[model samples]
Target: MKKFAVIALTEGGAQTARCLQEQLATQGFKVEVILPQRLAREREIYYRKGDFNSTMHRLFREYNCVVCIMATGIVVRALTGVVVDKTVDPAVIVMDEKARHVISMLSGHVGGANEWTRLIARLMEAEPVITTATDTEKVQALDVLTKKVNGWYPNFKENTKKINRRLAEGKAVELFIEPYLEKYVEQFNGFTLIRDIESHRGGTPLVIVSDHTGFAKNADIIHVVPQLNVLGVGCRKDVPIAMMQTAFTEFCQQHQLLWQSIVKVASIDVKKHEAAIQYLAKTLNADLEFYTAKELQKVSQKYPESAFVLKTVGVGNVACAAADYASGEQNVTQRYANHEITMALSRLHEI
Candidate 1:
């Protein structure tokens, strides 16, 4: 819940202001109203009573945002001392006496006032006022990406500020992609996918399709940090409603592996709702996007039209090709399941 100091400019406005504050407070807002006149008897609210302008500045510093039941333009003009910094300012929103609508006049971007106004408008049946480049574009929050990546513990304030700076300045941020076997590199699988690429750096030399080594020191190539990432999957014969998950995890523990190395689970398009697979992916905090049966069918090279796969599922095959169709390549870097099936891993650089 957000804390707001509602400044009531007039005595008559205090009741309406308290009502509005309660309206927001009921919607999980902790609001403390400052009635400059006198605290009312019907609806008593506690606040530090004082000069409106100075008190508002103090409240602005104390709270996430401020809500006022008064004329916004007049309030803004009264606080000529408050707009000292373009950045690092509190979000301030003003609602009219009747609380018909909310206006985001100043500090719309830096203060995150626009989003707060939207929430306020939503609860009070008021219109949210928004006008900012990033908001207008509806950019995805970097925090969401941080949440999606298991290993990414972000420095939110610093990272977002730098990212925002780069975005504002139109700078390019480079990411590197590398895929290799964990046993070969002695590192986690798929951990090298999002490594930063630099002008020049060293890397674990790669062995080709076979066990062969390539030199990076003598080669003319830029330096890149390899982030390994692999998608491991197990599904029903034809992905029959999400049971493939148990088989996949069983495959993982059957072999010795931690789930963090696996990015997402996969299956033929028909397995989209496979319960066990979906639950497993959700448990691992990963995604279960599928490809066509023809994709994974490529792995084993021979999966005749199964009466089960065809009747039970629309897909006609169960080869690694089918998994690869949804995943990528015939790359079964790790395999399990009585040798009859595999919990394969695929690497992807981009969405």
Candidate 2:
């Protein structure tokens, strides 16, 4: 569940916070109210008697998003020492005491403050104060697009503001799309499709949509990797996380696959609780799925088998079978295994 922190100081702010908590709860948010010592009433209120800034700092570290129903100046001053990078910072929104306006204060784009602002404003019938250039200009934001298509932005730390500024100025951007995504390119504006690399002239921001990795990087190029790959992993119970990471990276690099394109890490149900595989999945922010030995046996790929593996796990080919089951693809990479771990990859067709 999405966690939300609502900080309120006054009686009027507490009333607004309660109303917002009810509305947001219906939409599946876990909203918690943080109140000053004197204003605490309900059992749910987190009453802090000491410094407000310290309380806010702790809340900012704990919650996914924070809403302040107080003066904008107060919110800004309270967060001065706790603010971090946009990619990792939690979304922060400020609302007027009367709920007449909702402002997206920080982490508007990547952290989804702008989107939350719109949702809260619509629910409360208040005016949304979005100051982001792309939002104000109605330009399609790159971060939003990447999230929608399950793509990864490799150079977001370096190139986000530059690309958004170009788009805000209505400058044309160049897009290199895989044939499967050609039909969907019309949804974006200010983009000219480049059919061939030789035919491309270089005067605009570039977006490349593909599953390959290590494309040449330029200041203007943004590599968008679609989440089209699934990895089936088999490992000894005591395999180390570092060894798994090395094996996974080498496999992707050898196959020319983008490590970021991996959407799921699959394995037999018995190895579902393996720490190394779980750590790898958490690092990629992908789903970890486990299939029963019976379910894996149903996949009819002609994978190489081991009698010892079959005797141990009831499936002769764990990696290939799990990959086929997870990605619904018959093709798989050759088994790449170290002494401790085994991995195979499968690519899914574009939707």
Candidate 3:
């Protein structure tokens, strides 16, 4: 479950914190209210108390989100030494004691502070202070879209800020949409759609919305990879986690696929307890789906027939059938095999 911490200082802050905590709890968040020792003890408020700086820092590290019901300056001071990269840091929001305005103080976009700010503001009947340039200027934010589509930004190291800034400045940006996403082209307001690569119009930042990762690299190119790929695996019992990681990485590299594009991992139901495959799925943060031998047998005809595999595991090809079934698509990559595992990749087409 996602955890949230609500920190309050004064009496008004405490009251507001309680109200916000109740609302968040209803939305399936594990929330806790942290107040000062004196106020908590005297008022018998059910909360954690003492060491404001330490408590806030701990919550920042452990929680998915943190709402500080106090002065913005106090929240800033407490977070002075705890702030980190926006991508990995928890979303931080600050609300005044009266709760008239909710400010998205840290990790606004990718970390979800902007969205949370609006939700909390609505609950408190407060105005949300969204100051992100792309949002205020009505430009779509690529990072936020990435989150919504289960997509990833591989070239985010240098171009994240640059792309958003250029969009906000009204500079033209071109996009190449894959066939699966063609129907949603109208959702993007400021991009010129490219029909093909051969036309090659130059001089603008390019955004490629596709499931493949084989695009040529350019300083201005941003790849928005949707998580519509699935991986199927058949591994020897007791293989180590390192070997699984190496094999998966090699499979992605060989196919020119992004590791983040794999949304799920699948295998024969018997292998569900295999630690190596389980570890790989956990590492990828992908869903692990298992198929019975009967289910695998049904799809085996669509893939390469492996007589030995069928005799041993009751399925013609574990990796191919598993991936094909999980993706609900017939298009799959050729089997990639290592010493202890056989893997296959499949792409999904969204209607």
Candidate 4:
């Protein structure tokens, strides 16, 4: 179920969230409502925040997406001091205290503002205000991987054209979405929608979102994507894991990278393999590792953050560094694991 954190500005905001929660419950989404203390005059509210900072600190750390009963930007801005976790930044949705339309306010693309809005709109028979580029496009039916779209993925340049061409042709197309991705439906459309193991009839076009291989046998399900990128980082000495994380996030955004694209976390043996790195990786369902030092020195192209630990572990940095390097060729574009993880994605082309 798509998880949502409903945050209300006032007592009535909390109650509004409750009504929406009951409605969303029927649609199969996990919903939790957050509110301030003694806001509602009539109804006895269960939730109350003592220290606003700590309350939000714990909440963002736990939830995937947050739906604000009102404007939540202030709450989010205030919590910046304590909690820095965005691993599961709740797709922020704004609903009125009057229980009007559910408006997706932030994280529209990946956090699922679009699909959640569509679902709520359907339930309430209200209009879903979707403000996204990809959703309003003319999509084609084709076997194309769902690449993370923080910006232009040079590798996807080829695949995008193919999807457009297929779309232009009027050939029947089928879209495949991860059942778990139900929350993101509104952000995307135009392609035919399909659930797991569900095959399409005849030669319809297919779009897919899977972390593994072998989705459907028919040419109908055209693409299979790992749908995430695994980042194996080796920072220089004493580069606090916090700094590493901050820097990495900046690098990704600067590169228009998708936070979801990073699945696994990695580091070299010399770094003591700290908890912060593991925490960041775990948030993305990725494992943490400390490879031999020498292994990294070799794949110097993607340098490991070299430290004295290299002297402790005998191996060179080559292995760990090579672990980060990808074949410059666009065909080597898939990730969710280290380059050495050995994936047979080529089979996707067989159909």
lDDT for each candidate structure: 0.54, 0.82, 0.82, 0.51
lDDT of 4 by residue, 1-351 (tens): 556666676767777777777888887878776666666444533356556556556666676666666654675575576543222355656666675666766555445666677887777666677654445554422221242321122234455556656555544556666664434233443566756445666655556665434444554444444433445554444546566567555545444444554444555665545555556667666545555545545554343333443454443342234235321111222322222221111111111
- When 1 and 2 are scored with lDDT, the better candidate is 2
Pick out the ten consecutive residues of candidate 3 with the lowest summed lDDT. Answer: 41-50
For model 1, residues 1-351, the per-residue Cα lDDT tens digits are 567777777765687777777777777878887775455554555344546677777776788777777887767866677766535567788888776778876566546577678877887787776655445544422322222232232244655455444433444432232334323233222122333334323443211111111323332222222222345454454444334545655655654445555556666666566565667668777666776654454454433345665555455444344445544455555444442344655544332
Off by over 4 Å in 3: 38-50, 154-157, 181-187, 235-256, 272-351
* True-vs-predicted CA distance for residue 307, candidate 4, Å: 59
Tens digit of lDDT per residue, candidate 3, span 317-340?
899999888877774689888968
Name the TM-score of candidate 3.
0.75
Each model's number of backbone clashes?
Answer: 29, 0, 0, 34
TM-score for each candidate, following the candidate numbering:
0.41, 0.75, 0.75, 0.41
lDDT of 1 at 30: 84
The stretch of ten residues in a row with the least summed lDDT in candidate 2 is 181-190
Which portions of model 1 miss their true places by more than 4 Å?
Answer: 42-50, 84-87, 106-110, 141-351
Candidate with more favorable, higher lDDT: 1 or 4: 1
Residue 17 of model 3 has an lDDT of 89
